[model samples]
Target chain A: MPHPPVHSPTILCTVDVVLLTLTADGLQVALLVRDRAPHAGALALPGGFVRPTEDSGTRDAAARMLREKTGLHSPYLEQLATFSGPDRDPRGWSVSVVYYALVPPMAPDDGAPAAVEWHPVDRLPPLPFDHAEIVRQALARVRSKSQYSSLPVHLCGERFTLPQLKLVYEAVLGERVNQVSFRRRMDELGMLEPMVGETVGGAHRPAQVWRVKEAFRGELSLSERVLAGRD
Target chain B: MPHPPVHSPTILCTVDVVLLTLTADGLQVALLVRDRAPHAGALALPGGFVRPTEDSGTRDAAARMLREKTGLHSPYLEQLATFSGPDRDPRGWSVSVVYYALVPPMAPDDGAPAAVEWHPVDRLPPLPFDHAEIVRQALARVRSKSQYSSLPVHLCGERFTLPQLKLVYEAVLGERVNQVSFRRRMDELGMLEPMVGETVGGAHRPAQVWRVKEAFRGELSLSERVLAGRD
Candidate 1:
């Protein structure tokens, strides 16, 4: 094997995204029904094969598929893991670069493809291929990073009250966080900015809305002791 | 494109491993010199194209490469990230599923093809392709995860004292850790077990040697507030 085999088997290379968004019910994952065979009509992550000529990177391909399926571009997108197994796909040895995309609440209407829908992360329907495992890994990454990083902010809208942010955190973490401690931690993180003229009326009173600081918007930022007791 | 294309581009798929090991000086990474054209004889991470038929997963491929190049199977091998870009490989659009493998102290002797050498992580020479970036990401993940998870323990020998473990952590983290806090955090993690009859002679006294608990041997375990003040 001194000379490498130029005609090595051509394997299928694709990207799958676990697009997560926070809804009134809980954290929902955006999925699309596979229209073609192998698992036709089965709900799958909104993704497609990485076009060798066009895609600069798998991240770009994932972002493109996300935009085409959900009509939204994620503010926070990261590669969750790469799932490549001999038996994972019926089509030869396929490698799927799994990514998790986080977006604010939006109408998942990419038109014509009415199959794109948001399903609660906790109770997803049967997913095709190894998507269930992909989703589980994505959820683990999101939850683990949320403990110390400013990641959950991407799931919130442009403006949100502290209570709303806490709800988003609770949904992702699956635990009730101490309000005062969470607030203190957020304040110490300094990743949020108050929306001066925005206030949402709640049952108790008017709550001021906050947006993630511009510096922390493009990439992830970490804070020490963010989840002190929760972790 | 309702129907998928049957002749999707034959993208080049490969795996690159960042193999880290503890050395007498400090933490070092193993590298191999490429033998073929396009950057022959340049230092590169130990890697090869995924043999689609033989490999069960990218992780298995990476581990095989580790064994072939270094003659040691890593106890802590994980998928760091997938680095794929149009310009990454000169041959074609290539996707490199980068992985990081950690091992205890070992001799990296692969006989005749003695191209593999361990270089200090902090002072690495120029590497081929996007391997430098892969190393950077792997190091960041190791440092970040070591703060909370039982990751650095794998870099130590089978039996090590608390001081030896602290040195391993400091080397991976690039900072000195407080001895008291480190011990307390390790105790809370419950990922280490003392060997009843093992003790290493030190200047002051004989120190009890500990090994990672059996339950947490092959996987990473996390603790709350592991690096309480170090972070």
Candidate 2:
């Protein structure tokens, strides 16, 4: 008879989110302070175990986790990367599916359950586990995504001025974009339309506000012009 | 005296690669056969344990495993996602970080050490674990990335005809693209330049070949014009 073969060990799985929102201060992200061990009292991304019922599919699990933790329904979410090192967590060898989500800046509802708070991205506190590194990677992905797609709009309110949208893009990309060029590009992409009877007041001028067109909701694609000079 | 709490079992960590290449048969990907218990002898993505190394990162471990399993050297690799579930594997709880890589096609070296083979993307056999899902997600990402950036060039030879380049793009995207539109888009991105002395024999006429410009390396930004549809 052949001898029995040895088998590899099992691993624990979890999902974490880097939820971004544009704020007056700058680009902000939601983080939670762990109230348990392994990284007790340390800042971390909002996450939890993947329930068995939620494991019907890959995207399903991620979506479920996102909604449960953030209270945002079907937000713009993309898989960032996974963090699975032996020492990433002191408990054991665990793997985390990290996702990045873009949401409009708004105060949480009175019934929002998670013990989390939004921190301006530029001033993030040290995070638990390998979360600080995860946040960095997520921001990089957001910056890259903003260049080709209309994802920055997801971080702004429903009705906004072109300058407000431009500021969101600049905040995420960490660069000063030419105002004229930015508006021209947005108009070309059909990302915005003049809001009916809407104006935003500033110091000297009342800027016309615009809302994202419905047709452009799921039509985001990478821009070839931006790719040309990226390298 | 305070009593310590009972801890959960230890989790195992692993890394898997969605190794892709461009071949005469269109896009091809490498798959391995698991020879041990727990999906034994089943087709699977090439992967291995994450060794306890002080210097190597998660991606570094993935690259090392990919190089060891496949004879190809990949210059383009990105972290796809992590798979973790209590019962994903019958053996125990296990988490796997999946990485996607694009490699140029070539015959396997005689000294290559793994029992790996490349299968056309359209005719892939059933894979072990959750590898089939990993491949699907990786392909989707590759297609989306190709639309904005010149990433598909990494899957082609250093110098390739426009027809060959177009075919590669279509295969990854799973769609038929208008040749005139595709050519115009490529030209506007400035990703490729006409080669001085390269021609490929075709039935009717000799097709001119183009080489990817060196200045585009490591520049993965998308074009504003492409998004705006100005070109």
> lDDT scores for all predictions?
0.83, 0.73
User: For model 1, what is the error of residue B186's alpha carbon versus the real structure, in angstroms, after optimal superposition?
Assistant: 1.0
Residue range with the least summed lDDT across 10 consecutive positions in model 1 chain A:
A107-116
Model 2, runs deviating above 4 Å: A1-7, A10-12, A51-74, A108-115, A179-181, A191-224, A227-231, B1-14, B36-42, B48-61, B71-76, B83-95, B108-110, B126-133, B144-231
Alpha-carbon TM-score of each model against the true structure: 0.92, 0.71
- lDDT tens readout by residue for model 1, B36-143: 766888988989889877899899998888777766655588888899977888877889998888887665353424666888988999988888888888998898
lDDT of 2 by residue, B1-231 (tens): 332332544445678888888877788888888776667787788888776543145687788887777654545788887777656666545667888888667655644455887888789998777788888888887877777667787888778898888888777776776788777778778878888877889768999989877876544535343321233
After superposition of all CA atoms, the RMSD between model 2 and the true structure is: 6.2
